[model samples]
Each structure stands twice: as structure tokens, then as C-alpha cells.
Target: MTLRATIVRPDARIVVQFSCGAASAVAGKLALAQYGATHDVQFLNAFLASEDADNRRFLADCEIWTGRQFTVLRDEKYGADVQNVFLRERYLKGPHGAPCSKLLKRRLLDAWKKPGDVMVLGYTAEEADRLEDFRERNPDRPVIAPLIERGLGKEDCKAIILRAGIVLPYMYRAGYSNANCPGCPKGGEAYWRAVRVDFPEVFEARCQVQDELGPGSWFLRYRSGPRKGERFPLRELPYGPIRRNESLPSCSFFCEMAEADIIHKEPTA
Candidate 1:
């Protein structure tokens, strides 16, 4: 199957988000194939100090695949540090999401985007529900979900990335689902335990951040599931939990909060 019929305004710049994952890489390549020669298209990433170095290598390989260099967009004010986000914002997440996502990613998108740019995301067909939710929640965003449009799945994306001669990010090889921050709060007990084993230093740093956030502030907060409000300290987690077949939420700079300047959306004062 081919991509959906897309029209690129000659003057509109296409802003493709590369999250250092296979799906995003495939989306970026398809965007270039469709619009790069005739339109202004650029790839962007919200870098974090906490992301794996493998992410950088994957990005470099993707750059070669696209034949275009990425324009790295960062929120210098936050220094893109997860711990800094907790200390300054005084919390990890709120009604919206983790503060680090808003400050580092959404804020920069807010600053860099303009009227004629269309934001493109790599939500594969497997994520049709998320794509639908994003469309419903963000009617104002000039965004395109290409993978879903093309009926591609995660495995399809992996094949596409391999066909381009690029290696998948190390985390994917190491058994993590996505190449998000090593200690991303979107993870659960099992995910954190994996982090403790695969990324010991990152695990220690997140432990420090959780302590700094004080009691009751944690990575996992299940409101309705069996693990309701399970905010157990990562320090106490045993290694046996690491092998559970569980999932972690995917992280996107924009999708995390859906909007920048979420001061009014803060759950805490």
C-alpha cells in the first residue's frame, strides 16, 4: 500500500519529529520522498541529556537515509535535564504529564513552529487509537500522521529502517519498546526494574530525582488499574519484577502535553 494523498503547500514547511525510533525514521523518509524536493521540509528532535548515546547514532544514520541534516531544537533554559525539571517545577507529572516533557519539548515546538509548517508524527497503524485521540484533542495542530495513513505497523517500520541501512536504537535491541529517556516516568514497575539492570547509572539518577520530588511523587500512578496509585520508590524494587510482560507508554515531545506553555495546566501551585 502507498501513503495517503497528501498535498504540500509550496510555501509550507514540513516539520517531521524524529524520536530516534524506527517509526519516526520511516515517517521522516516518506515525508522527504513526498515533499522534500519541492517544499521546505526539515526534521527536528528534542534532545535530552538522559537519552541513550545509541539514540545519537541512530539519528546520524537516519540523517544519511533522508539526505538532509536534522535541525536540533532544544529548550536551552531547562538544559533538557529531567532532574532540573523536577526541582524547578517541583513535580514530575501533573494532570497533564511529566514536567520535563513540557519544558523541554513542547516549549521548543511552541517557539520554533510557525503558520505554514505542518507537524508530522510517526504513529504506526498499531497506534491508530492514539492518532485518533491526538486528532480529537488537538484539532488546531496542522499535523499529519503518515504511518497510520499508510497502514504501516511497528514491524513494517523496522523493516523500512533496515532497508535504509540504518540500525535500530540500542534500547530496542536491549528489549525496551522505544528509545525514550532511560528512566522515563511513563514506565511501570517492571520497566523501572529493567532500567535498574540495563541502565544502572540512569536508574540511580532517577532515584535521586524521585527523592528530590519528595514523597507521593512517583513515576507510576495508576488511577483505575489493579496497581492504583502505585507510587512505590524505585529503590525498593526487586529484580524479579523485570521480566514481566508489560508495556510502557510512548513518549513524544509534543504529544506528551499536546501544547506548550502549560503553566495554567499545572496540577500544583
Candidate 2:
């Protein structure tokens, strides 16, 4: 008996979610290159018309490599504005993980997705929970995780980009784990600590936002109770020089907040 083979023709439109991070952007670029080479797929950037030069550069590189003119869906107004609203309402409380992901990244994708187009996410197998969550949330559309399928983790992604003679995003070299934004409210103490050292201005701005939101609005809570009768340290901690080879710290505190049921009931919609 002979087995029958079924081949699904590639869709004309493909959206690559670009977060300006090393791993995700690289994965998106690779996907675009592959699809452009093999099919009649048009690459779409989540934030194509934004003023961000870095985002523009990434798109330009994709076009250069693929030799195809990709269409960009402009949604500049909604991206940052909605993200700010989400952060102020939902994430300003305790360690709710980066609201920017929900507001800017995922929201952009949801808006741009069409009925038959394949949505490619830049998640690797290393982010198992995230991958599962993406699939669960967007069950209607077929979401492809090419990097995850290839067993390419963060390190492997970096190698791929470097081998292509492309420079990784500055945020990666600046010690950010994933580039959502500068001083994201979802950042943990260690992440903040690193930011305080690497990007002091951004860290200070985040503290200012926390201050304006008042008590209980702060993202960072002492893991352990404060020293008995001891006062909270109002001043910023002196962060040491970051090591180049040092692995970026995970947003562990934000993850805990989700588990601990500490999210504020602010409607994202």
C-alpha cells in the first residue's frame, strides 16, 4: 500500500512579529528569508511605520536579503498608546509581566491577521509555556513556530544572525533578556538592577512612573519581608558593571505575580 502525501500551498501573506530583540527578531528575519525564497509570501512588520530606526533597519535588511518588497501595515497610533494604557492600568500593580507584549506585540498581530494567512511567532522551545499560550489563545489562525520546531534556542538564534554578518540589536548587547521596551514595568529586581547599571535614564524613568502610581502600584516587592522595623531603601542600588558573557536574568518576579494572582483587574480591551 502506498501512502498519500498532502501538501498545503503557502499563503500569499505572512506576518513576522518583530519585538526588536535578538532572539525574536533573528527568528523573524530567518522565517522571512525562507518564505520569500520558497513561496509568494509578503512579510509584514508588527510596527512597520513607527519612528523607531531599529525596527526600520530590520525591515530593510529583510527586504535586502529576500529581494522582495514586503508590505507594511501601519498601526503606529494604537501600538504605543494602548501599551501605555495597559501598563498604567494592569501592570503598574505588582510584577505583572510586560504589558507591552500584550498591548504592542500580540495586539498588533491580532489586528493584522487575515483569514488564511499563516502567523509566525518567534518563540523557541525554551519558552514552552509561552508557545502553548500562543497556540491556546489564537486557535483559529494557524500559528507557526519554526525556530521551536528546529530546536533553536536563544544561543542558536544568536549564532544564526552573527553568521549572516548582521549585528544583533543594541538592547541585546545592553544586557536585556528580551527587548520589549526600555525599563518595562514587568522587570524584576535583578532586571531593574541590571537596567540601573546599564541604562540609568530608563531605570530612573520607570521609578518615576512607579512613584506616580503610588503604593501597591510598584512592580517590585521585597521577595522576603523587609528587615524587622527596617526602612525601605528609597535610593537606587549601586549596580556593578555587567559582564559580557553573563546570561540575561529572566523576568522571574513577573512570572510569580501571574501565579500568585496579583494582577489588577484592568480591562485590556
Candidate 3:
């Protein structure tokens, strides 16, 4: 009698980091459309307390649109609170980066991400430089940036999400460019001013964080004059019209993998 051998092969896992922004939402959709049959694609989110409360609503909408639920990861130590990360680390922003990015996102990713899992992000055609920077830093990790490959930009991503009948998050509607945590430390003068006006509670919370971190801790910068490159405090930022041109760098954990979401026809505020 002859015996035949049987082999089993598991589908490769494609982990999409969905940050609840339009770009990421579209990217996740694209990844699913392309790989859902051949690969085990999973959407992941590094939830932060600082993001707008409406992010949860947008997240649910995206899940319905995509027909796939996200595996949410968060900094258990800080309960995914950016402020707690800052306070515990005894630091805010610096030349390297912010502690919240490190502790809230990256560390959680390191713990949860598995070997042999291909990662996906929302880097668009305009962000090829960022994609390249991430690859240069994380040569060992396999990644697939669908937005970049498809020549899509942020607007394209937003359009795609809108077509899918999902409402964009409140942050984007409010005129802040990206869906990063409200009062993200990476914001500039205009960004902070927008935060102050649109999200006064969040702005004041960030100011309180700076006060807690104490001297030498700052989240803004002086664009010109002798103070150029000096750390500017959030409280000192003057109220003014927000310049819509500025966009925040993506703030997911893997951003340092380099580094650096959405919905809807939701009407712009």
C-alpha cells in the first residue's frame, strides 16, 4: 500500500493600520479588495483618547463600509491617553519625537504585531517621500502602501470614502487637515490656533500637560526671528485664523517605522 502526503498552508496575514482617517479607511478598503481572498487581511487601530470623540462614529461607519471589524490596540498603561503618555514619560515634544507616539502607538504595535505579517498604511502618491523614509528605516518589515501604489492622494482617499457613504471624522470637517489626536504636539502655530478655537478644551488640556511637564517642554516653534527653532509653548500661541494649508504628519506607532483616517460626505463645518 502507498500513502499520499497532504500539505497545509495558511494564508499570509495583511495587517492594515487603520487610523480612522480617510486615507487609512480607503487604504484598508483597497487592501481588502485586493487581498481578501488570498490573504488574511486585518484592520488595526491604535486608539488614542485625544482624538475627537466623533472618531468612534467614523470608525463604526468605516467598519460597515468595509464589512470588516478593526482590531483596536491601545496603550494599556495610559489607557490610550496621549496626556498620560506625556506625563509618565516626563517629556512632550523633542528633536526625536513625542513620547505619546512612542508609548501609545509604537509600543502597542510592537507587542501586538506578529512575525510574517505584512503591514499596510495610507501613504498617498504625494507622500512617496514618507513611504520611502519608512522603508529605509524598517527594511526588515514587509509593507504594502496601496494608496501610493494606486497613485491616490489624500483628496482621492476622502472622495473614495465619501462615495462609500461614510461621513468623515469631525477633525477633518473642522478644517484640521489630518485626523491625528486633537492638539497633537506636532502642530504648528496655525494648527495650535485652530485647536484653540475649535477644540478649546483639548487645547487647554495640552497647555495643562505642558505645565505639568514644566520648563523647556514645548510643542510649537518660532518660525522666524532670533527665536527661530526655539520651543514655543502652546499657551503662548495667539488666537488667529487657521491656515488650512498646513497638514500634520501621520502619527501612528510605526511612523518612526519611519515616521509619521476618514469618512464621509459628512458636510464640512
Alpha carbon lDDT of each predicted model: 0.76, 0.52, 0.77
Taking all chains together, each candidate's TM-score versus the true structure is 0.86, 0.69, 0.87
**What C-alpha root-mean-square deviation, in Å, does candidate 3 show against the real structure?**
10.0
Q: For model 2, how does the per-residue alpha-carbon lDDT over 1-269 read when each residue is reduced to its tens digit?
A: 12112232564455555444455556666666567666555455445222234556655665665566655544454545423554456444334355544444445555666667765667665765665654444454455666776678888877777787766656666555554454555445566666676666756665665566554454444445444333222134434444433343222212332332333334456
Cα lDDT over the full model 1? 0.76
- Number of backbone collisions per candidate, in order? 0, 0, 15
How well does candidate 1 score on lDDT at residue 128?
A: 78
Best by lDDT: 3
Off by over 4 Å in 2: 1-12, 37-40, 48-56, 68-96, 225-269
Best-to-worst ranking by TM-score:
3, 1, 2
Best TM-score among the predictions, by candidate number: 3
* lDDT by residue for model 1 (165-200), tens: 778898888888888888787677778778888888
Ranked by lDDT from best down, the candidates are 3, 1, 2
Give the TM-score comparing model 2 with the true structure, all chains together.
0.69
